[model samples]
Target: MESHLLEVLVCPLCKSKLDHNREQQQLVCKADQLAFPIRDGIPLMLQSEAISLSSSET
Candidate 1:
């Protein structure tokens, strides 16, 4: 994703800033403990599509 897009993107649930995980290709919302998927270069920001973070991830 572009830097500009990442700057503007936020967690859909908590509306908090997201940290980009380049290795995992995910947008992580620490506050919500959710990892939104980045599929085919597109971010799936929907809450329903978000994956709950593991204990180690939190």
Candidate 2:
């Protein structure tokens, strides 16, 4: 993702900053305990697409 685009992208639910998880290729919002998937170079920002984070991650 482009730096400018990533800068503007935030967790849809909490509107919080996201951590770029390069290995998983996802945008993680620790505050929201959600990880938005990045598939085929596209970020799936939909809430339904997010995976719940483990309690240890929060």
Which one is best on lDDT?
1
Model 1, stretches more than 4 Å misplaced? none
Candidate 2 per-residue lDDT over residues 1-58, each given as its tens digit: 7778889999999899998888888999989889999999899999999999997864
**Model 2 CA lDDT for position 57:** 62
Question: Relative to the true structure, how large is the alpha-carbon lDDT of every model?
Answer: 0.92, 0.90
Q: Considering every candidate listed, which one attains the maximal TM-score? A: 1
| lDDT by residue for model 1 (1-58), tens | 8899999999988799999998999999999889999999999999889999976985
| Candidate 2 accuracy as TM-score | 0.88
